[model samples]
Target chain A: MAEAFLRRHTPELFGLATLLVCVLGFEALIRGGVVNRYIIPPPSDILLAFERVIVEENILARCRDTAFEMLVAGGASVLVGVPIGVLLYRSALWRRAMEDWIGALAAAPIVLAFPLFLVLFGRSPKTIIVMGFVHGLAPIILKTVEGLASTRPVLINVGRSLKMTQSQMFWKILLPSAMPIIFTGIRLSWTFVLITIVGIEYLINLGGVGQLINELAERYDLPGTYAGICFVILVSVLFFLALERVESWLQPGR
Target chain B: MSISEKTSLAQEPALVVDDVVKRFGRGTEIVTAVDHVSFTVRQGEFVSVIGPSGCGKSTLFNIIGGLLSDYEGAVKIGEERISAPHPAVGMVFQEESTFPWRTVIDNVAFPLELQGVAKSERMDRAHHFIDMVGLASFEKAFPSQLSGGMKQRVSIARILVSQPKILLMDEPFAALDEQTRLLLGDKITQIQQELNQTTLLITHNLTEAVQLSDRIVVMTYRPGQVKRIVDINLPRPRTSDVVGSDAFGHYVAEIWNDLREEASRGMADSESAASRRATHG
Candidate 1:
């Protein structure tokens, strides 16, 4: 069975092998003392610290908080982004009016507005969430707009010939057709939202994965810092993998 | 025409076009894509529109299709003018209109679903047409899974389930290779003969026009107006072998001579615009 799976998925095996090599190489650099022990901890020490973090550090709660921010941000993006995309699809005039503005938003850095988010919301969960949402929303809106707008005129004509109501056309034709493109936005948003939440934690001194990593770093517990960093990487990869599975399941042809 | 004479064949039109004109752009530069062009597509007759590119043959089809409604003329089912699309006039675009999201069966079943037909009934209807298009086994296959010829077959199946009175095809075979185009053309002729379907096909392929059309309507380029309507005197039930005949060559030459200069100018304009775009970009 293992051999069969590998035979079917050769590229997957190669990618895993490469990732393992990088992890091993990073461990070797720390163990060999290529860098200061105070700065860079060995993987063995990191793993031991990781065991301790899992046992005592409320890993689930921090995860829940971060996940909460992501879910809210993702939901907000879908709600706002889909409608904006639909509106842009309604007319060439609307596309012309708002396309440049949307492009500008997609280009603008979220860090530039951190101070504003901080000032308005204060250093609370709301700040982190707002930050996550801010980072997350751009791609969703842009991709949704692109997806909905790019429907072939022929397909639309098919709908028209069917005597489909406007709402029916949107649900049955435009939305489904645009889904593959829209999923791209969601995928990018997930990563961006996670990064934004961590950034917010760092900037405002909130307690999450980002805050924990900062605290461990300040204490010079290189092993513990390594553990937190490793945890961050592990969680991020897991989140992305989960998102891919969901998107693939939802996309019929994929 | 009296109302009863017009309504002789139930709710469907015998050939309903009450002077339709489609315009593009605006102000002083407003280009009339389809000038007040009108023609009746008698039920069960194979009518073909031949012209150069951008001669608004496609634009005219779009208007009849109810895809473009901002036109100056009226299209009717019988006596009533149609301002929007209805399933009675199923269209197949020059490019494939098969839904990328759906399997062959589902794409074909789309019209039936819109009409609120039972799922089983629509599925049965879809399979019947799919079989007719020679894709019976690939009912569950997605549009992307099919080849160009197969994809167009699915597209044909999709329109067939609607049970449209008139089938409007806009260069459906233009994208295929010559071999596939000939094969599909034969297949189309056979299916239409079997179904007794009225079809209005638009194309630059004169051989196809001559082979399938009961009569061919040739039009002038830009501000597309009808140049002449020539009745195709060829025998019925045409096959690939029909193209090898003397009548076929004569028909092809006749159509080309009429359209040669226009076709050349259109090609030149296209090249220049493409070059300009490339340079500017």
Candidate 2:
């Protein structure tokens, strides 16, 4: 009975225990003067700073800004990449010619092209959104093509033998068959979009949590900087939980 | 009138494969899979096509089912030449083709859904076929949640719900164990007899063919052509126990007699290919 309970609540119990250890260790290290408090604030100080950032600094508004950028980038990646992927799947010539190039593009230093994006979009939110979208698109496109191409020939034969139209075949058979892999692509794209969004905000001093962290570091407010970093963690956790919910909704009993 | 008499009244050819020749490769290296294959399946008749491995029995099946349109000659259903898939023909493949996402009834109702049938009506129709296949209790079960034989039953129900005149089954029970194969074979025979479905089965198991078919068409080795047409006039309402009878054993032997040489020749070719690979590798 105890083992079953432990197994059932293992993640929550372990996560909290590890978190407590880290927090207490950090506090003890600071009090014992083993580490410089100016550089690494104790967890309690960071938590106090977190309260100040939430109440005084109004971090929620900046969170909304970051979220808006991510949504635009993530949405654009799906809209643009899926069609390109479908085209690649449909045309063998195009796929043969460009498949390797797509693989290369995914690993390319796409964010290094942010200056070009700035010039194109005039140093606005559009620049960061565009950077995030472009950086996220390659994985989505490659995965979609692979997903569609790797659909079982038997399923396609079933669709054809049932007298399904090309459109019907795509919607009823191909899309559903490719859904799990496509969802993987979407999740990967979300990761890339999240990273690009924060990185662009940090580099350009855009108005978001990354920019807040930069400002707090410049001001020598170590605790506030740690608090801002925590907000970043918060953002990541929110994204993960939201994706998990959507995944469960889309593929029940998976 | 009895069931056989009523079936004979509609004595039209349900499916006709006319001099169909399927080949692969280009230039001088071209190889024929099926050569000059001609046969007719009368309405409400059950025919089994048995052949050695790679004898193009499946290729012949694909041609008749409108999956391979590039083959030579024509396949016809009734009087119309078949170049594309028609609603009157349904196929159960050797592979597990049930969509893993859908439940038993949904997979079975898929064909009707494609025809724009209403949800309630299609469900009702699908339920009837599910019950016929003894899968009524599994109406809400996913394909992944079923046994191999049960999955095939779902595939069969899916095909039958379309109410096709011709049922093309390609080695549908080849993946199952011997016991499951025998039980499922008997269930298939019962369903076919009950519905009087016009079915053409491609199988390597001679006993299965003898148990289920009215006539078995045996094919030769590669570049397959009909080597013999063996009539199995066994008793009606055959069950799994029919295989124990002397008549079933005789029919099985007769098919084996025609098939033995072709099977050995195929084995010899494969052995030589393996030896060539072994030497080269």
Candidate 3:
């Protein structure tokens, strides 16, 4: 019967088995004192902390803070980045001047400039959101430029042949043509924003789930720290699910 | 504008390209594409521009279509000079130019949308043209969902919706198979006759030029210049069956004779260029 089940559900069975091995190994290492419990708490203790964080502690509030920061940063990135991308697409001089800079900025550690951001925006969620926005901006701008630039010249010629105005050509032909690529950029930017928001919260000791995790670690509450990290993971999963739903809702077909 | 307005505008040639010259690069490296090429299409005439490969037929077409304005001389639609794209001139490209994001009906309605035509009215007209193209069954299908020919049909419908007086087709069927090309040629003939659309088709296919054009303007190799203008004088309501006729064979033979020398010249030039690259590299 076990062999029959394994053949039918190999993928699921293998995945569960791998996870079980990990949990059991961790538990064994803890019981044998091969691993320090203070640094890496046992699976049972972490699971117990997860229950307490949900039922006893108000982890939802911190989750809400992180979610809100992500929204603000992601929204600002799109609003600012897309227009700048379009600007780069329109002007050859601007594109020549900024293209390399944009690429470099995207790969740079802009999240580390949180101290300057805090100095500018203060030690509030404002600084964290701003940092997130700045970190996310480059990918959105670069992608937008790429998407618009890569529109088939044949389509533009068709538009011109139809005597469409510049604005009309942009909205009707260019925008729709560039949409898939632009959305890819937006997704990338959303990821960057989420990372920046969480990282900033952890680094500067601001609000959000990141700060909670930081506090738990500082207090040497190993299980609580693990549970807080799990909360961050849950936030990320929910955020990604929501992003997928929104993307599908906006674009129906592949 | 209606047929009445078109008739009033018909006092002049539908389109004219006079002494148009286009060159690329700078100084000694400059290469002339279209060299003093001149042609005129009358009110409802179908003219095909035929040339050997590397001929500047496409450059000349672009000049007439106002896509390339940096040229000597003039291109006029009706009485007005075309320095930029005007509403009277519509171009059908050889490439897959349909918007893949839009459905057939929406693609057909695009020009009308640009003109801010009412949605219901534009859709009604789009549906009529879609049916004319025999793509009514797939009106809601996207370009990616359609065959190459169907997508071109959508492109044709889109251009027609804007009511351009002259249709400038740049080898529109060059990518399709021979069978599909001939079929589309027949459809285009029907559409041109029904709408009385003045068309200028650029093509490399002798059969296509002979089958569809009222007159075939044969062009010379590279720096393309008009060599001869052969009046088709074929009977109206031409179908693919017309190609089987004696006159069709005669026209095709004449065009082949006109093009044979130029085709050889073009081939020699390319072969020499390739050998030069082989040596230099």
Candidate 4:
């Protein structure tokens, strides 16, 4: 087991180690005046500024704003996308009719349409959050559809032979079998959420970590900006890691 | 003494398919998958369906198993007209049947759980069948962790936990190696003898059909219809050593001869389609 773990994760460990070395090297270069802090914030200054931000600012409020958006996006997409995916699967005619549209939405950049959305919804956090949801939702729907479509024919036959009701088949066979891919779509969903939230904050000035970064950068507080970036990176990594752990825990043998 | 008087859950032919027909698609492309197929599976009998691919043996199996209801005519389990999945009918399909998310124990226990059996009780019952199929050590392992034979075993164990009056197996060991096939075949025969549950297995392997079945039903190619049903007088507890025996060889020859003309006709049709596609392309 230990050997298997080492083999599976040696590259990840190498990456983390490499990142730590780069961070320390950057810090040393900045402190030694080999490079100016104007070029990039020193790690020490960034850490100190982050500590101050935590102590002074309502970091929780900003966090809550971002988190609330993510929650709303995740919950609403899971509810709406799963059924749409299943519906597309249950009928071939409906699947063919909607499939091209789903594929188009999944491929197109909903983020680029933010200006139009702002014109319609105005400059509000609700708009930012909904934009994040819209950006994140297409993949969830597509992946859920792909997952359901790709589930083994044998499992479907089992559902049929067992005389499982359509609902029972959904709850028992189709949904559970589709979960891994669907969750992967969910796992990938975070990427779009992070991008949408950060982009919106820069554009609309809603106070999230993204907005805080923008505000700090505007005031020439490079350290605060870097620190805010660090937090975003940390949260995104941790959020995905938490999701990975849950997916593995639910999947037997892992 | 009479067929009707003899019909019951415990002793009657557990599943009966009478003049059942199944067609795929419609209009000019209407393909009759199963054509007027009829069969009776006596309670505790191990009957096998043997035919070439596209012969609609699987379709017939599905009809009896109640997987497809869009077909014509009737299928009855004991005294009732079968229209839905009855828990008393357990099915073990090929290797892909086991759910990847479920452990060996949970996969086997699923039908029981759906039946509302308590978790602890279900696990206990599941473990017993798991042990019976020689998967005792891998109870907590997932389907991904198991080999193909092991996965099929888990499927078998799962089906048995329900103690269904009949077990419908669709080429359950076709994916496994020859050795595993022999072993699993013996295990299935043993289980049937012990439980005395009616069983109908559908397969194309003539040797496998010969070894595992007391009677074999052969079908023609597409627009498949039952060609002949041959009974084997071989004694029980069949092993791999029995494969080359005179009785086994005789059964194999009989089935091969019956299928030869259908096989040739199927090939001719296939060549014609290929020629058409070549011309069209």
Candidate 5:
């Protein structure tokens, strides 16, 4: 029974053990003065700093603010992106005219447009949300178009054989068939949205864990700075987990 | 009138495919797929159209099932001429067609749902057909969970639930193994006999065609044209058990001889086309 348990969890056990060794090794290096403690604090110091930062810097509020911005930006992107995708799929002329432009938009440095957004929406969370929304929109639209376009011809023929109307075909067959790909687009969209939101927060020092990290870095509090960055990593992990849950819920078969 | 007279009157033609000519491309690049093919399926009859690959059997099927509209053909079910999908015709496709997102019962009930049948009524009918296809307990199972043969059975049940006047199958069992094909063929035969259904099957497998069909329409190679229609004089209510009989072997041999010539001609045509491309290149 013990052997079976170890066999089932070998990768996880090995990964955790490796992580512990690395942390202990780094701590010893810092204590032995081989590495500069001023620049790279020991893992123990970073862990100790977590409690201080969480209590004093109001880390939970920062996390909540970042999560809220992510939620709003992600939701808006999906609401606007999916319909645009369906539109592009339905209209070949529109798709031919706009598809290249959308591709260009996806490749462009969308974060650089933060100043324009600040001028338009002002120095607030609104600016950050809008930037994230713009950054995330293109992938959702493109993936939606691709997903709908890639539905198998045989499946369409099945719908045609049943004498399904155009609207019925879109609703019953095309949309459901395109869903897995569309979910891929949504996951990608969320990643971009999260990066944009946190980056904008750090850049302007307005809200969220990005602002907290900027403040700690300026104060030269190495342990606190690293702790703030850890919170950012935590936020990303949380969003990823949430997205996976929703995806599985939506597509139980997969 | 007596019961015999009424039974004779009921044996009228259910489906007619007259002079179907489907051509692809335009002008200099023109290629004809199906060429003026004609056949009729009577009520309560099983007909198979057999041929080599690329013989436009699929094109003919698409036209009959109303998937392809740019064909010069008249496909009639009962008194109505069909250029588009008709309510009286149901088609079973060759590929994996059971919608991955739906359970077996839901997939089977899709047509009835489209026709605005009540949920309870459609579910009951779907259950009946699912049971008929030997997938009774698997009604709640998704397409992803089933094997290839089981998925095909789900599709079969889906088509059967609609209860159309005629069932048009396009190489439906061509993807299965020999044993699964024979077993499914037997199940299909049983269903047809039980329902007294009119069916038109498009296949390249001579054994499958001979096993399931009351009459076989053999077609030539590309630019597919009907070469002959051989009547199967085998007894009714037949199953795969008759496959070992001498008559079944003779029928298979006869169809194989007819198909062997066309298959070779098809191979030759492809070979020459390849050589022509290689020379030009």
Candidate 6:
């Protein structure tokens, strides 16, 4: 039993071990003057600076602001994107007309449009949120279309055989079947949203961990900058964990 | 006793597939899939449409089930002719149809839920069918946890719960191993006898047809037409045990004899098509 458990977790254990070795090796190299301390701080210094950055920079508030922006943007993207996707699925004309546009949107550097957003929404959290929303929307829409399209014809036939209404077919058959793929789109959207939000926060010198990283970097507080980046990582981890929970809740037994 | 009297032929016809002709493509590219096919499934009768691949059995099944509306045919369930999906006709697909997201009971109850049956009432009815399919203990189990055969049973129970007047099954056990297919065949026979379900099954499996059907409709190669209809003349409330009977052997051999030429023709057509593609490429 123990062996089986170990076998199951072998990759995770190995990953942790490799990470520990790299950290220790890097720490040793820096302390021994084999690497420059000014540019790249040792792992221990970065770890110790976490408390100082938290206390001095008010990192928690910045984390909260970033998280709030992310939540709004991510939520809005799903709310808007999913329906657009369903529309695309339901109407072939719309799909043909807009699918390539949506694909182009995904490929477009949406973060570069922050200036327009800033001008429209003002240089505030709204700009960051809007940028994140736009950045995230395309993937969710495309993935939703792809997911809905991938539903097995047999399943649709089953629904048709039952004489299910269009609404019933969408809710009971199509949505559930396409959910995993849609969740994948959500994950992709969240990643893009996080990246865009952080980039916008840093660019505009606004309120978020991104701004904290910027300030720490300007002060040449390398350890504190890394620590601030760690907090950003923390935000991402928390959101991903929450997303996983939601996905599992939505699709149990799968 | 005559075969008609024994097989309950006095009952009204539950389903009639009158001259179904389905074609694909258009103009120069047009290909006929099914042509001038007609059959009747009597109420409380289990009929199997046995045909080789490319013989358009699935096309016929789809037309009758209302999954394909563009076909040229009149598919009547009782008095009502249907060109689209009808509430009174339920179908079971050969592929895995159980929703992975739903529990066994929920999957079975889905049709009722669609019909706006109350939750408690649907759950009760779902449980009844779940028990009927012998998945009583696995009511809360998901489709992912069940074996292939078990999943098919769940799908069977699911379709049965809606209580459609006619059940159209498209090789519902074709994916299973030989043993599981026979076992499920017995289970389906039992279910049909219990519910007096008027069923029309589309399959290429001769043994499956002989085992589960009262009569078999054999179709010719593409532009598929009914070549022959063989009566089983076997007793009802039949089980897999009857598979060993001499009558069963005779029936299987007879169907195989009729099917051999059609099967070979289908194979030759496919091979020629493949070679044509090769040469064109």
lDDT of 4 by residue, B1-281 (tens): 77666655444667888898899997998999999999888877889988888899888777777777788988887578777767778888864688888889988998887778899999899989999989899988888888998888888888899888889888998878898898888888778787876888999888888898878898999989999999987887666678869988988998899989888888898999999999999
Off by over 4 Å in 1: A1-3, A31-33, A87-124, A203-205, B1-13, B16-38, B70-76, B261-281
B136-192 per-residue lDDT for model 1 (tens digits): 999998888889999999888888888888898999999989889888989999998
Q: Please list the residue runs of candidate 2 whose C-alpha ends up more than 4 Å from where it truly belongs after superposition.
A: A1-41, B1-10
List the candidate numbers ranked by DockQ, top first. Answer: 6, 5, 2, 1, 4, 3
Which regions of candidate 6 deviate over 4 angstroms? A1-14, B1-9
Pick the DockQ winner.
6
Ten contiguous residues with the weakest lDDT in model 3 chain A: A245-254
Model 2, position A253: C-alpha lDDT score: 40
Off by over 4 Å in 5: A1-35
Please write out the lDDT profile of model 1 over residues A1-254, one tens digit for every residue: 98999899999889999988977887888677786666666667877897777677765667667667767876787777778777776878988888888777766778568789878988788888877877777788788888887888778877877788988999889988889999898888777888888777766768577777777777777787778777777778877888789877776665
Evaluate fnat for each of the predicted models and list the values in order.
0.78, 0.51, 0.66, 0.68, 0.73, 0.93
Work out the TM-score per prediction.
Answer: 0.87, 0.93, 0.88, 0.86, 0.95, 0.94
CAPRI band for model 3 = medium
What's the distance in Å from true for residue A183, model 5? 1.1
DockQ (Cα-based) for each candidate? 0.56, 0.60, 0.51, 0.52, 0.77, 0.85
lDDT per residue for candidate 6 within B151-270, as digits (tens), equals 999999999999988888999888889999999998999999999888999999999999999899999988799999999999987999989999999999999998999999989989
Model 6 chain B scores worst on lDDT over the 10 consecutive residues at B4-13
Better of 4 and 6 by DockQ: 6
TM-score of B-chain for each predicted structure, in order: 0.89, 0.96, 0.95, 0.93, 0.96, 0.95
Model 4 pairs whose backbones collide: none
Candidate 1 residue pairs that clash: none
TM-score of chain A of 6: 0.94
Can you write out model 5's per-residue Cα lDDT over A2-114, one digit (the tens) per residue?
99999999999999999999999999999999999998999899999999889999998999999999999999999999999999999999999999999898888888888
